[model samples]
Target: MRKVLNVIALLLLIMVPLLTACGGTSTDSGTSSPGNDSGTDSSGSDSGTKKHKIGILAPAVTHGWVAAVAYNAEARAKELSNDIDYQIQTSSNAEEMTSQLDDLMTWGAEAIVAFPQWEGMEVPIQKALDAGIKVVNFDIVIDAKGVYRVSGDNEDMGIQGAKYIVDKIGKEGNVVMLEVPTSGSVSELRKKGFVDTMKEIAPDMKIETYATKFTREDGLKDFADILTSTPKIDAVYSMDDETSIGVLQAIDEAGRTDIKVVTGGGGMQEYFKMMPENENIWIESALYSPAMVKDAVDVALKLLNGESVEEVKVIPTTIVDRDNYKDFLDDNSPY
Candidate 1:
């Protein structure tokens, strides 16, 4: 009986060792496996990777330049898809833009890039800053605190325009300064730069200041009247490319050969073509490309990445004329 019991006990020990090795009905249901040692959650996704959220706010496309600002900003956002998720909102007025700002804030956007053209944006933009959202201003300047700005040198555009006009038409020529009051500080800064520079360089240069919108229609109608009134105008310090295009047309219709130069701003493809085609007049535009909005987008990303950036970034103005218009031409450009 004792020998039989010993054999049974030996068999039981061997069977138990084999069952334990095969993991018999012993499942680790609540514990993690070796494959999931990297701390993956129940959904099998790692929690360490997180993308930044960026918001872009621009005005409704009223002009080619405005359209390009939106286009370039979206293009850049797509290019950084791996690193960020973005939302772009286009508003027609300050009130609409304020609403859009609220929407972006609700969306939990880490940073916002704003291209505000209208007034009354200060209060709402300040509200955004108070919410701990980083705001990046593009093109148009606003009165909001803690906002970073990225724009072309507006005042330097005026300085370059004055220099170009004086160089082409001489120091003592008559210049028609077309100012767009609707453009606010853009017109103000450009005008200030031109006037200040002209005063320092060509004090005797007769400047006829007039207000006009930044449109071909306004340029044609307003310049036609100015051409009729001022018979001996040597140049026109037009503040926009669209305005300059119309001014050229008005000059052609009126058959004015007295005007020697037409200065413009905002780099337009059509205007660049006009520079080479018009041989008689020195057609010049201080190159303020709307693509600068891309820089504003970049600044927003930099801020979100905890990178140090300037409070204000101003892209230097490039003077384009018949001599170098081809170099500035972009067939894909909307403006």
Candidate 2:
């Protein structure tokens, strides 16, 4: 009887651990299911379906080009279907930008597509990376490794702009440069290419640089000051179309016929319209179209679908003048 009681006790002890082990395994299996992971159901449609959440941070639409970028991003996000969800946030400055990014991370963003409006956003971006979020820097680039970047060939655009200006002004003349902020990578590369090419091709030409913001009003004010400071401005190379508009206004108001050419980047409608008719002044522009949002979205989708993309994807840019204006001009184009 004693042996039988000991055997019964041993059986009970063995069954207790087995039951406990089964219970723990059940709990873990429940937690580890596919649907319970955060941001894995970004579509927010049917329950139990896997999904992805993508966040986008862009600059506020202070200008036409930025506005176009914002519009395209929103439209493309919606068109991507129910498997992916996107949250877009716009910021006008650095403080607001950081706060917005924090909110997105809290909401369980699996990936981020950011166009850092200014410099010094590296810290917040690095934080996102530490949290295991995949980041894609669109249009603008920040100095962060392992982050994908999609942008136009800014240096090439500048080289094209310089070539156009040199061709119009001949070997030797006084050329005025309307410059944007140095903090932006696009602006820096474009300016460098332009300056270097000018030195290479038109060694005799004197180049004057004037600092201006990426706005029509700033362009006008800065160019007005340039007109007052410099007497013999033979040609003007505006960095952007908005700046070119202001430069054109300044030149028209000052009646500066000595300015033979006004060249710009970006395919603005106003510039396209002016290129065909403005024969005397030789109006030409490098085409830095604001269609990169579509490309970014496409790449993001490919990534989500388990495909690989290049770390840095550069969209091709072209020069648009009167001779080839028709090829680039789209009547229904947003930019």
Candidate 3:
């Protein structure tokens, strides 16, 4: 009985230390404590060697504007810091975007910047937020809470475009609008601003709006169809540079000399070049600069550094025309 008692006492002495080291406790079920770390320093703090990871989700480079955005974003990310790493994902459609976002999250991105090509991504955005990741939405507005959105004033672009038309046409002619995609927030705001301003300023002018996808091919096809159906189109206003290119193509093919002007948003290099020289088709373009990417990344860096930023950052827009185009034009500008 004495030997048995001695063996029991030795076992208790060994097991008690093991259990305590393993964080055994009556209140907790698991063997390890939730916040305890065995490798922490004397101050109970982690070393500051871990670098931050940033993820960028941009739409496919389908047009010059999108291409510029991607270029500037990649360039700025590399130029930002050595301790910060970035991964970029491009998606052709909404379904691909869903999967791309999932992969980004799984890669342990500390923060994400997105230019959503389509709507209905609120679920994925919310999921990232739930996981304690910061989200910065660029260009496109997702209408979700706790997201930092950065873009130019979309409605102001429309108001400027419409005011230009009214000034040029002098308030009384048939005008046609080649609109951007109705599903996009930028397009919708621009379209609304244009229509409202036209009604307020040029009430006598007859305005017709065509809702079409913002693509060169779609713009050409839709503009051609409209020209065939309508007898006279005094002026045409487009929401994108690619769509403007299409409208120009259709107008040249039809040999319609009656149309006075064509205007587009986005400072595409091609549009800037043509606006100064082109006599027949394009006359003006509103400057919705693609340099907003740089600003967004700058804001993200500030946030990561524990700095404060405005919840909504709005960049300025300018009207580019023959008179003032030279001021805003940069021959070496990528866009």
Candidate 4:
């Protein structure tokens, strides 16, 4: 009886081993299923990155900076292909963007990285957030309560411009404010920072503001009119690179040397190149790279992975001048 019991026990041990060998729960850590690993692509292939769907929305390239925004977003998406199933859509108007927003939802986009250049998008953006999609608003800050915002230091652009102008021409000079009305919150913040900072530093200074579009033609035309009408203009705060280009042209055409300082924003390669050569007028720009859109992609992925992300990712501005423009220069860059 004892020998028979011993034989049965040995047989049971051998059967258990065989059962585990055939098909059993693996002791291996971090696997989705038998085929799908931790980093499984849409094809269920191992690539060391968890699959996620991210959507990119941008305005049609109306200008060089917008073109760069689109380009950088695409480049970054391809760079993160192993981890992301990305769809990028560009729109020329708000209506087109509304339709594209719905299309993205239909495509099962779990996350969206949007640069809503046009206004009245608060509804669609909120709808996306309500649908359990994580929206990372880039470039322009929407008025939605919970959506994440990623943008440059527009206010600092104003602040830096103020400080530099004050230091260059003393606190008592007349300053021109070239404002883009369509810039929405970006323009508002920058205008506020400029006004507030200048008030703090130069209370006696007078600021003459004129509405302008973010185009070189407008800058050239409007500022040429401005130079003729307004006498003794010490500085001009043109908050856009394209517009500054036009303003510079206007100044050059008029051959005005009294304008001591011209301040602009948007990290344009062309404008940076103009900085060193033009020593007659102090030209400076507050750095705001369209390449910073890559951070929105990273933020979306982090949120999809259940990682914590900041509510407002305010990218700081770098004050660029002739001495430091070389650091930000990219010869092959589209912008």
Candidate 5:
């Protein structure tokens, strides 16, 4: 009887070890256990917490404003790193941008913030919309349907430029208007605002429109030629800060004393520095900041999270001149 009892006890010990091993395996299947080396429950912490994937499409750094657009976009992305995963692509032209768009789509991007400055992007952008990927446009306007846009008040910049010029140089003066034709809607809206406002307030104001690109090199070269042909100019309406910088240099080099006021757009630091230095010329800039791209990124995220957003969000323009230029100055600003 004693031998049989000892045998039963030995059997119970062996079965206890096997049962304990089976229990551990069952625990791993249900929750965290020694076999579950991942240190998470069977119901993962990341089950419903997948990060949103966002893609940014911008123009390559052709200008300081363009560079700042990319810079601000990256800054905003970093700020929201935990909430999102992002990819930014810059291109010189439409074809390159289209290829980048395809890459982003292939990567399973949930939303794309596009700055399609070049033409022929409408078809590709529309395709992205059809695929159910949200697109948010920055600055330059395109004809893509259902795409959100975030931009400074471009037309108001022209209106403010007109108002500033009229106030400083008076209603009667020869104004050389530098218009950037390649900018498409941006130029048209700004020109329309300036022209319409000028006609309404100062119909007698003699305005001459000329084509120029948005570069200091173009501004200097074009304005130098404009100075030679057109005499007795009172004010110059320049649609960009870089262009105005060139225009200012041409005026200084030519020793022209007739020009009293110069209006500019886009918040540029170097251009703002010139405002206080040149006491004679009322160097004014209507603030169309590259920082506005941050808002575009925000719009993209908002749409991804199923939040309501406006089709177009136009940020109001802030007119900065010699008096207020110092207030708007940022040493960290790339543009």
Candidate 6:
């Protein structure tokens, strides 16, 4: 009886071990975030380095330069495809952009890189911050308090334009200014740089600021009146390529020969072509390419991946002239 009992006990022990090893259940369900897999890094929380969600926003191709912005952003997103789940959206105006921002929030975007080309994004950008989603504004600087910004050296572009215009036309000459109202600080920073630089370099120069749009049509109309009203216009610090083209047309139509140096900003192919042709007019442009949007995306990634990033990232400006314009020429590129 004792031997039989011993055999039964041994069999019971062996069977229990087999059952536990073959089929077992755990009490834990594993870690999970309710809706977002890539969420919760705005406060510098660590991400496990899996597939993250990134949202890219830009203005619809309003012009050649804007088209390049959207294109280069897509290219950069593709370049980081392995690590991120990205959605890029473009808008024609501020209202449309705000609606698009709502859509992005609903889609559970981990981080957003936006080119707020127009004004009136203050609310949406702030809401994004309140929700703990990382926000980075590109190009056109927004007035939103906490959002990060990445843009070309808009101020330096102005500084360079101011210096170039002063150098070519002499310290004291009548310089006409063409300003874009919708461009926000893009126009403001460039204007500020020029104004401040002029104060130091050429305080006595007769300067006049006129309102204009970025479109060639406005440039033509606004500058035509400018030419008519302001006689003896020695130089023009036109802040855009499209604007410069119109200004040139107005100058030619009016048969004005007094203006020697005509300055432009934002590299444009059409304007570059004119540089060599217009030997009489010292045609120059400060390089502010749309491809700088790529830097905004890069900074967003840095923030998402628990890496430190600056609140403002400024890309330095390069002056493009007839002598060096060929280097910036890309016939296939829209901008």
* All-Cα superposition RMSD per candidate: 8.0, 10.0, 10.5, 7.6, 6.1, 7.5
* Per-residue lDDT over 140-167 for candidate 1, one digit per residue giving the tens place of the 0 to 100 score: 7888889999999999999999999989
lDDT by residue (tens digit), candidate 3, 1-335? 99999999999999998989799544333221211222223343443444467788888977778888888887888775444667888988788887888898888777888888687788888888888888888888886778898898889988988888888777889999877675489888998888899889988889888877767898899999999999898898788877888888898899888888888888877777777676754478888888888888777777777899998899888888777776876776677
How much lDDT does candidate 2 score?
Answer: 0.79
Worst 10 residues of 2 by lDDT: 26-35
Q: lDDT tens string, model 6, 37-104?
A: 54323343444566677888889876767888889888887787656778889998889989988888
lDDT of 5 by residue, 159-234 (tens): 9999999999889989999999888888999999999999999999999999998899999999999999997899
Model 6 lowest lDDT segment of ten:
27-36
Candidate 3, superposed: residue stretches over 4 Å from native:
1-49, 280-282
C-alpha lDDT of all candidate models, in order: 0.89, 0.79, 0.80, 0.87, 0.89, 0.85
Model 2 agreement with the true structure over 106-218: per-residue lDDT tens digits: 97878788888698888998889888888888877787766787888889988888888877778899988877874488788889999999889998889888788877898
Best by TM-score: 5
What lDDT, from 0 to 1, does candidate 5 have? 0.89
Candidate 6 collision pairs: none
- Give the worst 10-residue stretch by lDDT in candidate 1: 31-40
The TM-score obtained by model 4 is 0.86
* Alpha-carbon shift of residue 229 in model 5 (angstroms): 0.8
What is the total number of backbone clashes in candidate 1?
Answer: 0
lDDT of candidate 6? 0.85
Q: Compute the lDDT of residue 134 as modeled in candidate 4.
A: 95
Between prediction 1 and prediction 6, which has the larger TM-score?
A: 1
User: Candidate 6: where is the Cα deviation over 4 Å?
Assistant: 1-49
Write down the worst ten-residue block by lDDT for model 4.
28-37
Pairs of residues clashing in candidate 3: none
> How does model 1 score by TM-score?
0.85
lDDT accuracy of residue 293 in candidate 3: 86
lDDT of 4 by residue, 197-257 (tens): 9999999889999999888889999999999999889999999989999999999999988
